[model samples]
Each structure stands twice: as C-alpha cells, then as structure tokens.
Target chain A: MIRIGIYGLGKISRRVIQGVLSSNNACLYAVCSSSIEKANIFKKEYQAEKAYDNYERMLEDRNLDLVYICTPNYLHTKHIQIALSYRKHVVCEKPMCVSTKELNDCFDYAKRQNCFLMEAHKTVFTPLNQKLFEMISNEEFGEIKSIDAQYATRLTEQISDWHFSRPGSGCMFDIGVYPICYANRMAKSSIFRVSRFQDEALIEYENGCVAHIATSWDVDMENTAHIYGTKGSVSCKNFWKNTEAAVNGSKITVVQESDFTGEIEHACTCIENGMIESPVMSRKASLEILKVIGV
Target chain B: MIRIGIYGLGKISRRVIQGVLSSNNACLYAVCSSSIEKANIFKKEYQAEKAYDNYERMLEDRNLDLVYICTPNYLHTKHIQIALSYRKHVVCEKPMCVSTKELNDCFDYAKRQNCFLMEAHKTVFTPLNQKLFEMISNEEFGEIKSIDAQYATRLTEQISDWHFSRPGSGCMFDIGVYPICYANRMAKSSIFRVSRFQDEALIEYENGCVAHIATSWDVDMENTAHIYGTKGSVSCKNFWKNTEAAVNGSKITVVQESDFTGEIEHACTCIENGMIESPVMSRKASLEILKVIGV
Candidate 1:
C-alpha cells in the first residue's frame, strides 16, 4: 500500500482522509494540523498511524510515500515544495498555487526530486466526466462549438471570509477554476484569447470554440456545465460533484459519485508505476487554466 | 375594436395574427406579403378583412389603426417608417431595427406622428416575469448583483441562412437580444461597459451588477435566464418564452404563456389609452437593449 500523509485537517482534508482510508492501494499514515487537539481527534477517529501539529515533522516521516496538501490557497506552493524535498509524491488541491510562476516552480522541484505531482481536481477523474471526455474524443456529439459552465453560491454570511477577500481569494480562484478546467480539457484547442470581468470569463479557442464561465458568491446559481457540439450536447447539473449526466436529452448513468477517492486511487496507481504526474490531471493542463485565470 | 394590420406574412406574422385574433380588443384587418397567394391564404385562414402583396398598399387602409411590423430584421425600420407616415400605431418585433440610428429615427417619427410604437418583446409582459420585477422592486432578494441569460439554438442545416450572415444577421441580433432586454429592464441600472466576443457578451452595470448574455446558432443550449441578488436568486427556464419560474427554489406559477398575445394586448391597451409607448415594452427600454446589442 502507498502510505499517505495528509497535510492540514481542514474540512477538505477530512474528505481526503476518508478517501485515503477507502482506497485499496493507499493507507492513511499521518495527518498534520495546526491544532494538536484537532489533529489527535482526527487521527483517533480515522485510525491514522500518527498525528503531528507541525507540518515539517510529518514531512520527515519516511514511511509516508505520498502527501495530500489541503491547506489554504496561499500556502499550497510552500507545502508542496517541502513535501517534494522529502521525495514524497504530492497531490495538491485546486488553485494549486496563486500564480503560474509558483506552479512552474513546484513542477520543476518535483522533477528534480523525481517525485510525482498532481492537482487534485477530482471532477476530471470521475467516471461521469471520463465518459464525457471519451465521447468528445470519439466525436459522439460532433465537434464542440461552445461551452457554458457556472458555479454560484449564496455565501451571504461568508463575505468576510478569504473567499471574497482581495488577496488569495475571489470567486475566480474558488469556483471559476472548475469551468476553466472543463473548457481547457474539452475545447481540445489552444485558447487564443480571453475576456474577463470580475469573476466571469469568456474564453476563445483557436478552433473558434468559445467557452463562457462564471462564478459568484453573491447569489445561488445552478452549478452546472453545458457542452454544445455540432451533432448533440451534454449537460451535467451539479457538474463539479456530479453523479450523472445527460447527453442529447438522454440520461447518462454514472456508477460512482465524484469524490476524492477517484483522485486518490489514480494518484496511488501513478506513484506505483513510477510516474511523475497524472495523465488525467496533468501539470500542463493546470498551467493553462491558471494562465486563463491570470493567477 | 382596434383594427390590426400585419406587415409580413412570415412565420412570426402568423403568430401575431393569432394573437390579434385571440384578443377581445383587437381584430385582424389586413396583411401584406411579397407572395399574393400566401397573403390571401393567410387572410382567409385567419378571417382577415383584406390582403395585399404590396406593403404600401396595405398600409393605406384607413380602417387599420395598428400595424404589426413582423418583417425581416433589415426591413423593420422601413416598415415602421411607412406605418408611422400613415399615422398608425406600431408593434414591431424584437431588434426593432438594425442600428441605434435607425431606432432613434423610428422613435422620432413616432413622436412626430403622435402614434404609439412598442417592440414585441413578450417576456416582459408575462405574469411570471412581472412577479420577478415586483420582487426586485420590493427588494425581496436584496440588491441585484449579477445576471446570466442565454438563448442558443442548433441550426446545423441552416448554417447558410441569414442568421449566420454578415450584415444585419448573427446570433447577437437574432437571440442575444433576449438577455439584453432582461438585463435592461431587470437591472434598472445603466450599463456602463461591455466586453464581447463573437456571440457572447458581458455587460457591467453602474451598480456593479454584471450581466453575462450568450447566444449561438452553432449549438443547442438551455434557453434560460438566471438572476442573482444579494439575498436570494430567481431562475426561469426557457426564459424567453418562460411559462414558469423559481424564486429561492420554490416554483412561481406562470399564468399566461409568453406569446405575442401578451405584448399585443398590452400594446392595444396602451393605444386605447392614447399612450405613445407601452409601459411594459417601452421605447426607452428597447433603446437601452439595442445600445447593448450595438445594432
């Protein structure tokens, strides 16, 4: 089994811990949290081998073959670099870092350390989305002409949170990345231009396909993605965490829910095969998304 | 009863004829078509009083007090001018004309002729949308923040039609006007800037309420509009011809289907009251929408 160390015990990290425990090829080895009490409780509840209040201490654990970075937006690059220095494969969450330069640095450091690095964009790994990719490749819906994707939430009470703040937060980094990733993967063409305002963006691909993506904390919107092609179209409601899809008005059965398990399973398989990155969630794709987001 | 003459016996003209026939305050008086056979057939089928192959000859009928200009996009201004010259009230289709100059000219002529002129944008008159407007005015959803509206249709076989042509044709003029009108009336704030690409646009209002409107003939999309406010949101599926709406997730029942009847009824009421413009589908509203469309 690939022994896993989880950095951060935030809400998302808890899901990562559950995913690690559920995976057959991975085991929950350690957890790092700023609060020792929270770390101890999490370790005890999840049956993790060890809990560290300090991130550096957990990174030094030689038994941990991989580390899942689920820290805040700004701290991702630092944690990934530290984990790579210890020669551990890394799976970091979305908005992997705040900038393209930081992302390139992380990839370079991972290459030098000969360790695997992948952004934990779970949506792309889900069976539903995989089927979508396959359909696009096989021209099931003909050539894609346009895409409309959005994720909006009424976080009225959380306006003061980092998500709406100036630095390290905004709807673009928080939720807009989902559609940006969708556009990048599905467009299958190089993005030639982008026009954005506040948290909304319109991307134009080289092949003339255009994608409109929007995210907002001011109101609630249907968290959906609509992909339009020449012959037919595919729509996935609650696309980020979808368990089903519809193609040409026909429901597409999705066997598994989009959870962290898929990414964890894929991460373990890639690490075991001595691969440095995930085929589904590649560093190049992440870079392209960040470039569009200008971060 | 108000005698109505329809200029153009095209597909939409048939709907206008049906609307006029169904209204208690209106009667189908005359029809103008390039094909005399089609015009006579339509008049007989709809029980109209007269039919003319020449548009100017039909406009000369003294009994026809109102002229519904349902001609092609490029012919709207000329027809509206001719109807105004005959001192007849006019209800033209969406995109009243191809340019702001033409719109201003038509409005000027209507004022000088002492006649009413209204665009047949049926969505604004629907009971479902009226409730939404009332809710916004009452601050039921707090201050408005954003709006997303799209109308896309797949015309794969008709790619060579006028909808895909250059002058006075494109998705923006054909369908993007729906969202533009939605934003114009619902925003109640002046749009200060717009960034657009191909068939998509992002309009930013003075109060920071950004509206994203996209339409295309290249693909099929959810012909829906989503309005976002600070407290809650409202989404109307099939928004342009919406029969239902949901406010904060509870369905708002729509009483009347969004057909030409709503606008026709309103136009007839406005004309009977000696008004120069519709309260719902106002000339100012139409001007604002056309400005955003830039044609």
Candidate 2:
C-alpha cells in the first residue's frame, strides 16, 4: 500500500482524506496540523495512524511514501519543496504555484531529487473527463473548434473569507484554472494570446480554437463546460464534478461516482509503476496551466 | 384595423404572416416577391389581399400602413429606404442593416419622413425579456457585472446554405446578433472595445460590465443567456425564443406561448399611438446592435 501523509486540516483536506481512505491501494499514514489538539482529533476521527503538530517532524517519518499538500495557495510552493526535499512523492492542490518561476523551480527540484510531484486538480481525473479525452482523441465529435467554460460563485456576502482578501486568492487562481485546464486539453496547443476584462477571459490558441473562460465572485453562474466540435458538441453541468455528459443532446453515463478517488488512485498507480509523472496529468501540463493562470 | 404588407417569400416571412394573422387588430394586406409565382402562391396560401412581383409596386399600395422587410440581409437597407420614402411604418428583421453607415442613413431618412421604423428582434419583446429589463431597471439583482450569451447551429453538411457562402452571412451577423442585442440591453451602455476570434466576441461596455458572446456555424452550443449581477443572476435557455426564466435558481413562467406576436403587437401599438419608434426596441438600440455586429 502507498502510505500517505496529509499536511492540512481544512475542508478540502477532509475530502482528500476521504479519497485516500476509500482507495484500495492507499492508506492514511499521518496528518499534520498547526494545533496538536486538532491534529489528534482529525487523526482519531479519520483513523489515521499518526498525528503531529509540527510539519517538519512529520516529514521525518521514513515510512511515509507520499505527502498530500493541502495548505493555502501561497504556501503551496514552500510545502511542496519541503516534501520533495524529504524524498517523498508529492500531490499538491490546484494553482500548484502562483508564478511560472516557482513552477519551474519545483519541477527541476523534483526531477533532481528523483521524486514524483503532481498537481491534484481532481476535475480532470473524473471518469467523465477521461471519456471526453478519449472522445477527443478518437475524433468521435470531429475536430474541436471552440470551448466555453465557466466557474462562478455568488459569495458577495462573504467579505471576511480569505478567498476575497488574500493576496493570491483571486478567482483566476481559485476557479479560473478549471476552465483554462480544460481549454488547454481541448485546444491541444499553446495559447498565443489572451484578453481579460475583470474575471472574464478570452484565450486564443495556436491551433485556431478560442476559449471563453469566466469566473466571478459576484454572481452565481451555471458552472458548466461546453466543447464545440466540427461534427457535434458535448456539455456537462457542474463540469468540475460531473459524472454524466450529454453528447448531441443524448445523455450518457460516464462514471458511477464522481469523486476524488479516481485522482488519488491515479497518483498511486503512477507511484507503483516508478513513474515520476502521471500520463493523464503530467508535469508539463500542470506547468502550462500555471503559466496561463499567471499570465 | 392595422394593414400590414410583407416583403420576401422566405421561411421567416411565413412566421411573420402567422404572427400577423394571429393578432387581433392586424390584417395581411400585400406581399412582394422576386418570383411572381411564389408571391401569388404565398398570397393565396396566407389569404393576402394582393401580390406583386416588383417590390416598388407593392410599396405604392396606399392601403398598406406598415411593411415587414424579410428579404436577404443585403437587401434590408434598400427595402427599408423604399418603404420609408413611401411613408410606411417598417418592421425590419434583426441586423437591421449590415453597416453603421447604412443604419445611420436609414434612421435619418425615417425621421425625416416622419415614419416609424422598428427592428423586429422578437427576443427582446418577449414577456420574459420585459421582466428581465424591469428587474435590471429596478436593480433587483444589483449592479450588472457581466453577461454570457451563445447561439450556435450544427450545419456542417449544409455548405451551400447562404449562412456559409453569402457575403454578410457569417455567424456574427446571423446568430451572433441575438447575443449582441441581449448584451446591449443588459449593459445599458455603449461597448467601447471588442475582441473577436472567429465567431466568438468579448465586448466591454463603458459601465465596466463585459459581455461574452459566442455564435458558431461549426458546432452546436447551449443557446442560453446568463446575466451576472452583484447580488444575484438570471438565466434563460433558448434565449431567442425563451418563455421561462430563472432568477437565482427559482423558475418563473414568463410567457404562456412564446411567439413573434409580442414584437408585432408592439409595432402595431406604436403605430396606433402615432409614435415614430418602438419603446421596447427603439431605433437607436437597433443601430447599436448593428454597429456591434458590423465590428
């Protein structure tokens, strides 16, 4: 089994813990939190084998084969570098790094340390997305022409939330990455130019496809993604967590349960095969997404 | 009773005939077609009073108070000019003119002739759209932030269709005008800048609100319109012919039967009241929509 240690006690970390617990080839080995009491409570509640208040001390555990960094966006680079220095495989959350320089540094360090590092954007690992990738590869929907993706939230009242006030917590990094990643996948080429007005963006790819991405904190939008092709089109509601897709107005089931387990399982499978990067979500793709976000 | 004359014997004119026939105070007085056989057949089928192969001859009918110009896009300016010279009220279809110069000239001539000239954009006159306009006027959803609208058709095999081969029949002027009109209504301001790639456009209004409009002949799209505001949002599916709207996830029936009658009725009411333009779809609004499309 791949022994996993998580480094946060936030809401997203809880979902990651659940995913690890549900995976057949992974086990929750340890958890680190700022508060010992909270760490102990989380370890007991989630059936983790060990709990530590200090992150550095937890990294000293030789038995832990992997570390899932669920810290804040600004702390991702620091936490990921520490995990890689410990010679442990790393799974960092989305917006892996705020800047392209930091992303490049992390990849270089991971390669030098001979440790695997993957950004945990679970949306792409969902069964629906996998099938979409398959369809695009096989040209089931013909050549892709354009993509429209949106992720907006109606959180105007949540003024005190870090998502609104934090330095690196704008919609571009938090939610805009989803559409950018999907657009990158569908365009299958580098984005040559981009024009943005507030939280809305129009991205032009080198392959003649354009992507319209909108993310907002002021309004509640239909969190959906649409892929338009020459022959037909596909659409899904809540595409980031979608389990079913509609192709040419006909519904089809893509997965049984749309959860985070598929991404976790993918990480474990890559580690088992002694690969440093997942074939589906590679390091180069992750870097490209960050470059687009940072732009 | 209001007497209506129609120009063009095309698919859209058939719908216009149906709308006029269904109205309580309107009668189909005359029709003009390039082909005399088609004009006579249309007049006979729709029970019109007269048919003329020459458009100029049809405009000479003193009994016809208004003319519905449903000819090809290239012929709109010419037909409207002729009708205005004859001192007849006009209801031209969407994309009232292809260029700003033509739009300005038509409006100026209509004003000089003391005749009403309204663009028959049925979407904005629907009951649902009226309520949305009222809500926006009252700031029920707070300040508008952005609007996303799309209308795409999958007609890859119909290469010979005018929508693909005609000079002014690209997606921008065809289906793209719908979203442009909707965005213009919601923005309530002039669009200062626009960036376009193929059929997709991003329009930035002077009031800091941006509109993302996508129209395509290459693929199928959701055909939906979403308006995002500071406090909440509104969405309508098949917005061009929508009868229902959702405000913050609560569905409301806005119209009993969605048809072209609302616009036709509005035109009749304006002409009855001796007004020179429709209050709902004014001459200025029509010109602005055409300007955006021309861009």
Candidate 3:
C-alpha cells in the first residue's frame, strides 16, 4: 500500500482523509494536527499507527511515502517545502502560497529535491472540465471570443469566519483563482496582464481573448464558467460539482463523455502500481496555478 | 418618402442620416443641429428646405413624421418630451436620460401623446441574437442560470468629453447599458437589486437570474455577452453583430445563427407595419436600464 501522512486536520484535511480511506490502494500512515488531542482523535478514529502534534517529528519517521498539506493559505508553501525537504512526495491544497515569488521558490526546491509535488487542483481533474479542455484545444468552438467565469459564496451571518479578514483571506484570491485558472487554461496563450478591482478580476491574454472573473464571499456561493467562441458558446454551472453540460442554441446537454471518478481512481491505482511518480496533479501544473493565485 | 427630422446633429446623428438616406422608405425633411451653422450645412448637403437652430421652432413646422434624438445623456429627456408634445414619433439614443425619474417622465409623456418612443437600442435588432432568443423562449436551452454580459469600448481619451463624466456618463451607464439590456431581455424580468462598484455591476432579478456586467472607458475595448442556461449557453461578439451559437461540448460551428443584419432590417420594417412598440427596448425597458445605471 502507498502509505501517507496527512498534515493539518481542518475540514479539507478531513475530506482528504475520507478520500484516502475510500481509495483501495492507499492507507493513512499518520496524521499531524495542531493539537495532540485532535491528532489522537483522528488516529483513534482512522486506526492510524501513530499521531503527532509536531509535523516535523512525524516527517522523521521516513515510513510515509507522501504528505498531504491542507493548512491555511499562509502555511501551504512552508509546509510543502518542509515535506519536500524530507524527500516525500507532496500534495498541497489550493492557493499554495500568497505570491508568485514564493510559489517559484517552492517549485525550484521541489525540482532540486527530485521528488514529486502536486497541488490538489480538483477542477482540472474533473471529467467534464477535461472534455471541455479537449474540445476547446481542438478548436471545436472555433476561435475564442470572450470568457466569463466566476465563483461567489455567500458569507451571511450563518457562515462568515476567517474569510473576510484583512492581510490574508478574501473572495478574489480564495475563490477567484478557479475562474482565473479556467480562463488561463482555455486561452490560446498565457495571460499578459490582469486588471483587478474590489471583487472582480479581468485578465487579458496575449491571444486577444479576455476573461472577466469575479468572486465574492459577501453573497451566496456560486461556481460557474462560460466561454464564448467565434462559432458557439459553452457554459458550465457549479464548476466543482458533477453537473451535466448544457449546450446553448443546440439540442446537446449533459454530455456523458467520461467517468471522472473512474479516471481519478485509475490515476491513484497507477501511482500504487509504480507506473507514475504521482497522480494527475503534476508539479508543473501546480506551479502555474500558484503563479496565477500569486500564492 | 417618409419625412424625417434629425435632432441633435452629433456624430451618431450623422451615422443615422447616412443609414436613413441609404434606405428606400425614408428621406430627410428638416434638420436641427445645436448651432445654426451646422444645421444650415446639413440642410444644404441633404437638400432640405428647412434648418432650425432651435428645437421649439423645428417642432412647430409640422411636416416631419419622425424625429431621431441623438443628443447628450442629460438632454434626452428634454428633447424626447418636446418631440412627444409635438406628436412626432421619437427615437432617442441610449441611457435615455440621467435617471429613472427622467425615463418615467418620458414614458408617461409618450403614453399621453399616443406616440411611438423607442430608445434606439440597436443591439436587439441583430439577427443571431434573435435566433438565440427564439431558442431560449422556446425552451431550447432549458432554464437560464445566469447572464454574463459586457461591452467595453476603449476610449479613455474621451472620458472627459461628457461620456465618462460623473453622474451623467461613465462605463456603467454608457456602454454597460447594452449588456444590462440583454440580460434583462433574456432573463425576462426586471432587476430587483444591484450592487455597483468602480468597475463592476452585480445585478440580481426577482426571477432567479443574475448578471455580472463590467465595462471600462479606461481600458481596451471588448464587446460581448454570454447567456447561460441550465441546458446550454449562447453568446455574441460586438453585441451589435449577429454571430453563431456553439453548444457546450459540441464540435460543430454553425454560421447562419451568426448573421444579425436581417433582424435589424426586420425590426425597422416592423415599425412601419404598425409595430410601433417592441417588447424589447420599450419605454419600460428603458426605465429598467436607467435603474441599473442609477442615472
């Protein structure tokens, strides 16, 4: 089995543990929480061999082959770098750092370490989005005319915490990064410049395609991206959900092109088979994502 | 020939004259420019018998059946009211007026005079857009999820020329009105609430549809709008240009759906066929446009 140590026992970290436990080829080796109490709870719940409050002490065990980094926005780069220095393959969560410089440095260190690193970029790994990339890259929609992608989550009194704080979290960097990534992925070339405002970000790529992306923690949550091609347009609602694809002005909707869950499972199996160093979230892609997020 | 009077002999007025003269059903009857010198020159060029420097004197002549108002943003209400008082069919340029109150007054006057009053919204006259609308209204694209519309004409140099001035004109009220209208049309509802910022407009309607419209007189120009439905999405470039509709995940790029010139001709012909008021771009519609623009 491919043993793994998960760092940061937050909500996302819990989700990662669920995903790992559900996978057939992987097993949880250890878990590192900020407190010994939470770590002990996770270890007892998951039947892990050990639990450690200090992540560095856990990394010294050398039995774990991979480390999952699921800390806050500020701690991602540092945790991933520490994991990489231990020569362990790493899967860091989104917004891996707060700036391009830190992401670049982390990438250079990963290259020098000669170990695998991947950002848990689930959007690119989804089935519908993969087909979207293929169709767009093939010029199926012809030349791109424009793009509008946005992710807005409502932060009413019921669910407002740590997201609206200054110096760290907000909608633009936290949720806006997905739509920006979508625009960057479908554009013919890299984004040349970005025009950022309070809750919106307009990015102009070199290939004459422009993307308008906005995010808001102030309103209810919505995840969607739309691409306007010369010949037609394509739209997807809830970019992170397993929703069906709907074609505008045509009879096609909910294209069952590929099984996304199956693909991800297969990738995990490949890693276990030693057929690949890591899974679909390649190190190179993670670095590019970091650059766009400026994190 | 249909006798026509031209009001507000500005640059757009010149374009309308060119279009009208080139048409078979219309001929110039009188000219009214802000200055007597310009009106006299236009009258001599078009071989008109009358040239009035003042609108009150021009309205008293009683020979013209139609009047086209191409004045500044703030002057639309005053000019349209005067034209309606004289029982002349009216076509006023965009923004309609500086505020919703002005639009309501114009609409009320048009109703009282039993005259035709349109805001000269040409985007709705595009053929490709017409096709998309037919498909959507016919439930071809299922229920709409959202509308992402934008129209940005890079004219930072002209920002000081009253078009981008505070209150009366800027990116949101000037070019942004087109996309807002499109969203309002496709959504089939009036906007209930709007959050405005320096660079963005977030509009939500009572009918469960949302529009994120961004425009800038300070940035490079890109004109486009994408309508997203639960079943599919439709898009057009240059909002004024009719273009193809590509369905999501489909490879085919159809062309007939892209041509919108036919629709413009048809809408204009409908006016002479006693279709004095259109469902799209009606007086009520202009009021909604003004509401979003916040005058």
Candidate 4:
C-alpha cells in the first residue's frame, strides 16, 4: 500500500482522511497540524499510525510514501518543496498555486526529485465525471457544442478570514474553479477565445465548443453542470463531486463512499506504477486552470 | 378600440391573429399577403374586415389605426415605412433592423411622421416575467445579483434558408434575443461591461448585477431562465412566454388567453394614452438588445 500523510488538519482534511481510509491501494499513515492536540485527536479518531505537530516532522517519517497538501492556498509552494525534499510524492489541492510560474516551479522541482506530483482536482476524478469524459471522447453525445456549469451558495455561516485576505481569495478562487475545471476538462479542446465579467466566463474552444461558467457566494444557485452536443446533452447537479448524472435524460449512477476517494485512488495507482506525474491532473492541466483565471 | 392591420399573412401572423382576436382593445381590421388566395383564406378564417394581395392597398384603409408587421426580418424597415406613410402606428417584429444606424433611421423617421412604432419583444411583456420583474424591484428577492437565461432547441425540421444567409440572421437573432431581452429588462441598469463568444454573452450591469445569456438552434436544453438575488431566486421553464414561475420554490401563476396578447395589450394602452412610443419596449430598449448582439 502507498502510505500517505496529510499536511493539514483543517475542515477539508476530514474528507481526505475519509478518502484515504476508503482507498484500497493506500493507508492513512500520518496527519500533521500546527496544534499537536488536534493532530493527536485526528490520528486517534481516524486510526492513523502517526501524528506530528510540525509538517517537516511528519515528512521525516521514512514510511510516509506520499504527502497530501491541504494547507492554506498561499503556503502550497513552500509546503510542496519541503515535502519533495524528503522524496515524498505529493497531491496538492486545487488552485494548486495562484500563478503559472509558481505551479511550473513546483512541478520542475518534483521532477528533479523524481517524485510523483499532481494537483488534486476531485471534480475531474469523480467517478461520474470520469465516465462522462469517456463518453464525450467516444462521441456518445456527438461533438460537444456547448457547456454550462455553475457553483454558488449563500454562505449562511461565516468562513475563515483567510478566504478574504489571502492572495487569490474571494469567490473566483474559492468557488469559481469548480465550474472552470469542469468545463475545461469536458470541452477537450484548447481555448480559442475567452471573456470574463465578474466570476463568469464565456470560453470558445478551438474545436468550436462554447462554454459559459459562473460562480458566486452572494446567492444560491442550481449548482448544475450542463453539456450539450450535436446529438444530445448531459447534466448533473453539484457536479464538482457528483456520483450520479444523466446522459441524454437517462440516469447513470455509481456507488461512492467518499467523493474524495477517486482522486486518492488515482494518485496511489500512479505511485505504484512509478509515475512522476498524473496523466489526468498533470502539471499542464494545473497550468491551464490558472491560465483561464488570467494568472 | 384600436383598428389593426397585419402586413404579413405568414406563419407568425396566425398567432398575431389570435392575439388580436382575444385582445379587448384591438381588432383584426385587415390581413395582407403576396398571394391574394392566402390573404383571402386568412381573412375568412379570422373574420377580418379586409383582404388584399398588395401591401400598400391594405394600408390605405382609413379606419386602420395600427399595423402589425410580421414580414421577413430584412423587410422590416421598408414595411414599417409604407404603413407609417399611411399614417398608421406600427409594431414590427424583433430585430426591427439590422444595425444601429438602420434602427435609428426607422425610429427617427417615425418621430418625424408623428406615428407610434415599437419592436415586438413579447418576452418582456409576458405576464409571468412582468410579475417576476415586479418582485425583483420590490426586493422580494432582495437586490438581484445574477441572471441566467437560455433558449435552445434541436432543429428536427428544416428552417428557412434565410436563417443561413439573411443579414443579422442565425440563432443569435432568431432565438438569442429572448434571453438577451429578458436579462436586459430585468437588470434595470446600464451595462458596465460585456463579453460575447458564439451566441453566449456575459453582461455586467452597472448596479453590480451579472448575467449570462445564451440561445441556440443546434441542441436541446432545459430552456429555463433563473434570476438570483440576496434573499432568494426565481426560475421558470420556457421563460420567453411562460405563464407560470417558481419564486424560491413557491409556484406563482397568472390567467392568460394568449401569450402574444400581453404585448398587444401594452401597445394598445400606449396608443390610447396618445403616446407615440412604448415606455417599455422603447427605441432605447430595442437599441439595447442590438447593442448586446454587438450591432
């Protein structure tokens, strides 16, 4: 099994722990937090082998085969470099880095260390979306002509202040990536033209597909992703991590324990094959996301 | 009662006939077509007061106070001029003219002749949308933040060749106007920024509202319109002429005989008040739709 250590103990770490627990090819080796008490509690609660107060301390464990970085958005490059210094494969969360230069630097460093690294875009690795991408490639709906996807919520509860003061903050970075990554993946073509207003964008692909993507935290939305093609269309609500979708109005579903498990499974499989980068969410894929954000 | 003459006895005129017949303030006084047989059949079928093969002959009726022009899109300016020369008010179909200059010329000429002229945008006059707009203005949903509207259909049958070759034709003019006009009427602010690709557009209103509107004849879609705000949201299927809608999940409906009658009623009211232009679908409103189309 590919032993994994999580480098953050924040809210999203719980889902990552669930994913690691459910992954057949991996095990939860360690979890680190600035607060040792939270780390120990998480380790005990999730049956992890180790817990460390400092990230460097966790990376010191020779048994830790991989590091899943869920640190604050700004700390990704530093945390990634530190993790790779110990020769650990790393899977960083989305918005992997705010700028193209920073993201390329991380991948180039990982290459020198001969360590596997990928951005964790759970939306693309979700079982439902994987199947949808394959279907589009197979032309089940014919050439994709249009795409519409959105993610929005009213934010009933207060969020971390980091969401406001951090670089690449606000809804565009926090929520807009859902629709952006989803559309970019499904369009399957390089962007020919793009225009943006607010957090919404109209992207025309080189192969003639047109996509409109939007996201907001100020109000609620349907949160559905729609793809229209020459022959038919597909749509799913909460597409960022959906396990069910409709293909031409027919329901298609897959059993899913933790929505985050697919990414973990894919990452573990890549490490098992001695791959230095993911074929799916590769360095190039991460850069493309940033390009659409105009980084 | 406003005495009405329909200049084109084509496919859409049937709906115009139904609207006029059901209207409380207008009557179908005349029907004209290039083929006298077709004109006579429509006149007999709708019980009109006059039938003429020639356009100018029909517009000469002394009692005809209004002319509803549903000719080919390219012929709008010439048809409107002929009817206005006979001293009759006119309601021309959408895409009243091809460019900003042509539209201005038509409106300016109508002003000189002291005749009322307006573009027929039945979407804004639909009972369901009027109520939705009222709720928005009343802050029933609180300050609107986003609007999304789309109309798309798979062309199961062949359409006219003009759809491919007419100036300012294609899906954007034939169908995109529905979503464009709907969003513009609901935004209630001048555009701060706009972007377009294919037939989809992202518009940022000066009041900080954002809208994404799209339409196509290439594929089938949900054909729904959604408007979101601080408090809640509203949505309706077939929003261009819908008689019912859902406001934050509560269904709201209104009585209706014909969808086209709403525009007719509004235009007749303006005429009765001795107004030479529609305060609703005014010269500025038609110009706004064209502007979004990048005229």
Against the native chain B, each candidate's TM-score is 0.94, 0.93, 0.83, 0.98
For candidate 3, lDDT tens digit of each residue in A1-295? 7778889888777767776776656778999988999999999998888899998998898798778787787778889889888888677777766676776787778778866566665666565777777888888877775677778764445433555563346766677667766776767566666555455555666776767676665443335566776655677777654445654445333443232333334445655565423434554455445444454
Which candidate, 1 or 2, has the higher DockQ? 2
| Order of models, best lDDT first | 4, 2, 1, 3
Sliding window of 10 residues with minimal summed lDDT for model 3 chain A: A255-264
How big an interface RMSD has model 4? 0.9
Residue-wise C-alpha lDDT for candidate 1, range A121-225, written one tens digit per residue: 877777788789899999999989888888888774534365555445887888788888887788887788887777788888888888888888777778789
Q: What is the C-alpha lDDT of each candidate?
A: 0.83, 0.84, 0.68, 0.89
Alpha-carbon shift of residue B209 in model 2 (angstroms): 4.0
Pairs of residues at least 3 apart in sequence or in different chains that clash in candidate 1: A99-A295
lDDT of 1: 0.83
Model 1, B1-295: lDDT tens digits are: 8899888877778777777877768898998889999988988999889989997788778788999888778778888998899899999887788777888899899999999998888777666777788999999988888888888887745443555564567778877888888777788787788777778778888878888888887788888788888888898877766777888888877666326666778888888999998876776787778767765
Ten residues in a row with the worst lDDT in model 3 chain B?
B251-260
Q: Please give the lDDT score for candidate 3.
A: 0.68
TM-score of chain B of 4: 0.98
TM-score of 2: 0.89
Give one digit per residue, the lDDT tens place, for model 2 in A1-295.
9999999888889989988888878899999999999899999999999999998889999999999998888889999999899899999988888787888899889999988889898888777887888898898888888898889887645443656565558888888888878878777777777777778888888888889988877777888888888877888888877788898889978643427888898999899999988776787788778656654
Q: Which residue ranges in model 3 land beyond 4 Å of their true spot?
A: A1-177, A180-295, B22-25, B44-50, B156-160, B164-167, B242-276
Range of the 10 consecutive residues with the lowest summed lDDT in candidate 2 chain A: A156-165
